[model samples]
Target: MEKMTLSSKTREAQSPTEKWMRYLGFPGGILLFLLILFLPPGAGLSASAQSGAACFALALVWWVTEPFPTYVTSLVLMFLLLVTRTSNAKAIMDVLGMEVIWLNLLAFILSSMLVKTRLAKRMALWLVVRFGHKATWALLAFLVLQLVLAPLIPATAARCVMTLPLMIVVATIYGSTEATPNAFGKNLMLLNLACISVLSSITMTGSSANLIAVGLIQNMGGHRVYYMDWMRVGAPVAILTMVLMWILGQKLLFRMKPGEQVPQVEGGLDLVRRQYEAMGPLGFQEKKAIAIFGLVLFLWMTDIFHMRWFGVEISAPFAALLGAVIVLFPRWGILSWAEADIPWHLLIFSAGAYAGGLALDDTGAAEWGVRMLFGGMNLKGVPFGLTYTVVVSVMMYSHLLTTSKTVRTLIMIPIIISLAKALGWNPLSLALPAALCIDWVVGLPISGKPNVVLFSTNQFTVSDNFKYGMMTCTIGVLILVLSGATWFHWLGITPSFWAVAP
Candidate 1:
């Protein structure tokens, strides 16, 4: 009777807190949607009131959750624009033909091939065997390995899936304390990988965003982004940020014991050696897959220089198509089509976001939002730029609001574009920095895929990641703002929407 009474009291006591937590869950998203609905028009929306309403209604739905697949959503949006006379069907569909989307799709297909061929694992094993001895050094090796792979594997989740299991194995070897050593090491490994991958993705071919950013620039400002041009601007930033992360991590977060041997790794090189030994020699199919991947990557990267000789622009989509062909070709038969379980939903999700952006453009909703946020802003002085700086800075803080950074980007980008136009500023200046800042999600274990993967080991807790991650993010933001200011100036661009009178 006493036991039953105690159970009843426990259940009763927990009910209110559960209710409170559930209510608090999606409040920010709800609030933002409400604000958009209720807010007065700023950009010529009164003139195109009906179109604006359609845009906002679509955005509200997009923001809430997907009732249909994203590509389906995008197609529906295109249909709506045509029916509403906001835009011709051709104009709505034009954006969907974006090369960036093709690049992402191809990138996914190639990544799939890599995993299927066990190439990613083979490469990782080769690196880990060489550096898996020292605990701290092993961490650095893992970071570098992932850096090399980031360009090829565009999806952070896919990257995490590839690396996380190996990291767990290494962690087990280190016998690092979950409270301090294991917790700190694991968090640092995942955060650095994810963050650095993000920084590297600024190059046009690196991530879908780079492509999207370029496309936006062309559509808005009549500028085209070339592959090498992106490299020139983004490469320096990637290198600098990578160095900062490594140096800071080594100095503060990850400490090495003096004169310690590399932790003894279990099933280490010995396992890899035995596995390789059993294979005896590379199979003909394996060789073909490798040759195909190498050729595809090389041809794609160097196509700009050898376009005439190559006789074609080797786009990411074409490369992926070739890769898929190689994989399922009867003679090669490395993977049957049935074994290749591609995540069709992700592709649709990406398409949906693309469509959503199209809808915003057609209805002039994006322009309206831009006007309200930055209309009449004078960025002639440091203070003016500083005012804009607040949004850029807060974006780093906003990572706390979502578990998925891509989701955050999808929602944030349109509003950011609107704000930039209103402020009379360059959208890329604000949007790129803000998009990059979303990577500073080191604050919680649940913050990113890599974080959650490591956290599932039950070695680290939310409080621990919060304590260290907050410090890292704070420092990272300061660096971003300072670097961004210098970069913008060097690019011969100014943030002000209108040119200051000479």
Candidate 2:
């Protein structure tokens, strides 16, 4: 009995390092748990700040771990925030109407119909079959398709979920596994999928974070990132990145044998075509969805210019809500309420994220954080362009931590802008594109919701994700820096980049 008791005690007393290693990958959850256990007294924050920090940690843990349904976790966090005064009840209530969240919900419904109708499947299979049997061509087709689909779809998860199953099917057909082909093909396919996904933010409607970035840019820096403006600057970068991906992806990730025959996928395109055909002449629901989506796009693109009738200006959020309502017109016999199948969990997550942002604003956390950060790393007498370049570069590379890219961007833009201005720089020149592309460096599945959806399939392992992620991040940093320098120069703000201190 004594020996048994001693053994039990020994087992219970494991080192902190050992426990930390077990949970290292889930930093968001671990960080939150630590904060809850040890709230610093007089941390120079209001009660709201403390409550926000706790809720932020809880929401983040749930988001990263996903032990409960994501929406449920989000709601719990939002509830905690409201009850604890982390956010005012009114502001917390307002999080529901956040344009990006509603847009994603509507987009998900349309995506569901596309899935049910097998339209997305048919499209992917068509690309695979048309590309002959080469792996490179297959990847290229997927990349091009994602780029084209991003502007229209508006939600990265919808895009990824639509395409990922098809990619898995293709990978399975090729017999690519972690152990097979020296882990080459598996890594390549996963990496390519991840790399292309970043392009989702190139358009205003592609990802929620991009929308948030647009709003923050306007609010913080007085610069509005219009839809066309984003496309104009972003399209070029996306095109160049895709080209580089083809080259590096093949060389670094996977090397296909020259004579390796691509396996024949049985009933591949035929199955997809047949399934789509089964939908049998588009229903009124699909037509209505098409019309609503088309109208939203038309209004957003043109509404910026024309607002004459009753002075009725159409905001993006309002337009999305309008489309969402039209989706469920009982009289029109369009989509049913049950058929919408919205991911309410994501909306909950949005509420928690927005609550955190509100907490920062309410408690002056953003301002306080900016001051401390500047005090610690004060770059003296640096050229404004050089300082801007360094700050933007760091911000872009810091996305390996969180799952919600929207939350990450929202957190960074406010702090970064505050810091940039204190350092004697025009914050917009440094902050605008940084706000836009910070989430683009998401190299892991947990870096964004799109990534999680893509990772759900057993196509890639965590190691596979990290190996490819590191390379992609390296490439991203270089591209962002060079592009920023070039774009600034083109805009007549020639940058004199300071050499990094050893």
Candidate 3:
């Protein structure tokens, strides 16, 4: 028995397949780099551009395959770009200091403050205590909590971590254990996952991928998507999707039992109330954090107004930095430097990805690739509506193939921009809707961190998640298509297919 146990442990420790998978990235990247190096430079692109394209291909392979840490691959990408003389060291490093990077950094600091101050938990507890009398309303309360927290906590995984314990508690109170989940438990867990991923699109700062998308859009010479612009388009879809999910959960998907209409969770409301009271009234630090965030949000929304009156625009990153500074001030600040949960790995990866994007632009590699892929397709004459639907649909459903939202953004946005240019349509029209689809990553357990986290609760099975996720994902795509045809058309985002010649 002892020997059998040892053998089992050894087998579980590291499968040969897993070992080879991790090592594949290095050789795969090398082969791609060599292939691009040896390929003839296409017309309208320089030899240096060809090298840059090769570096990007190497980065893409490593990023997707995960032979190394994603950030490590980013470092490799920067090193290769410099060694290959595709770009200089200074140029590559400067990408780290881009405005988008700072925006993400400040956003992280702000999110950390929320976590540290316990203000997010307080708000959630208050909502649940106030409205959680019934199972359906309790589920709605949690959804509302997520909606409120999404903008403040940009990282979906962080928000999920914060709420997971509470979700487990609620499930227990309702007599929905991991071994025996009621409809209410399954609904609550799945809905939490859906809300975390879907609502991430409703604000520009709601997720790093959204900001990355904005940066790439600007790289492609499209209009920058401001916080207000994203809110205008994404808010309606988010709200509609949440409402639809609520209805589906109650009626179509997970029908609540009659007893579930009024949960008999002994002391569940009291537990939440006590938790809220234990916070002992809002602290000075929480008040200060809220004030700083409010001011920052105001400045972000009224940026154009500032430019008009003061003849100087306050960019989003500047506003965020200002807020972060106040939140970290000596006297009234909410968080210490050590407490800031900054994901330096993601920052480094983003910097390298941005640099790669710049190389693609400078070397004309983006355009060259576009021409090579679409040049022979005669797609210039395709109708705008059909193209819009196809692009949005593909972007929405593509989440099943990969898990990293950043990777999806890095790969898809540039290609979409290039395709839009090739087809002579508004790049924003195609790219923005596609960008919104970045956070719709709840279709599989590996689709996103939140999905993974929620699945671990064991209240819902994989089949449960797949059913709920696929249905909602399909609905989400329809919402995008409908908005493009109606709301986007009214906003002048989608021009008439016949307006311009091919």
lDDT for each candidate structure: 0.52, 0.57, 0.74
- The model with the greater TM-score, 1 or 2, is 2
Better of 1 and 3 by TM-score: 3
Candidate 3 residue pairs in backbone clash: none
| TM-score, predicted candidate 2 vs. hidden true structure | 0.62
Sort by TM-score, top down from the best: 2, 3, 1
Sort every candidate by lDDT, greatest first: 3, 2, 1
Q: Residue by residue across 192-270, what tens digits does model 1's lDDT show?
A: 5445445544556665555665566566645565776666655555556655666665566544454223443456457
Please identify model 1 stretches exceeding 4 Å from their true place: 1-35, 42-109, 134-139, 142-236, 246-281, 367-373, 376-477, 480-502
Count clashing residue pairs in model 1. 10
Clashing pairs counted in every model: 10, 1, 0
Q: What would the per-residue lDDT of candidate 2 be over residues 259-323, giving only the tens digit for each residue? A: 33353345644553454466477566456555765766665545545477537777655665666
Model 2 clash tally, residue pairs: 1
Question: Which TM-score value belongs to model 3?
Answer: 0.57
What are the RMSDs of all candidates, in order? 10.6, 9.7, 9.7
How high is each candidate's TM-score? 0.55, 0.62, 0.57
lDDT of 3: 0.74
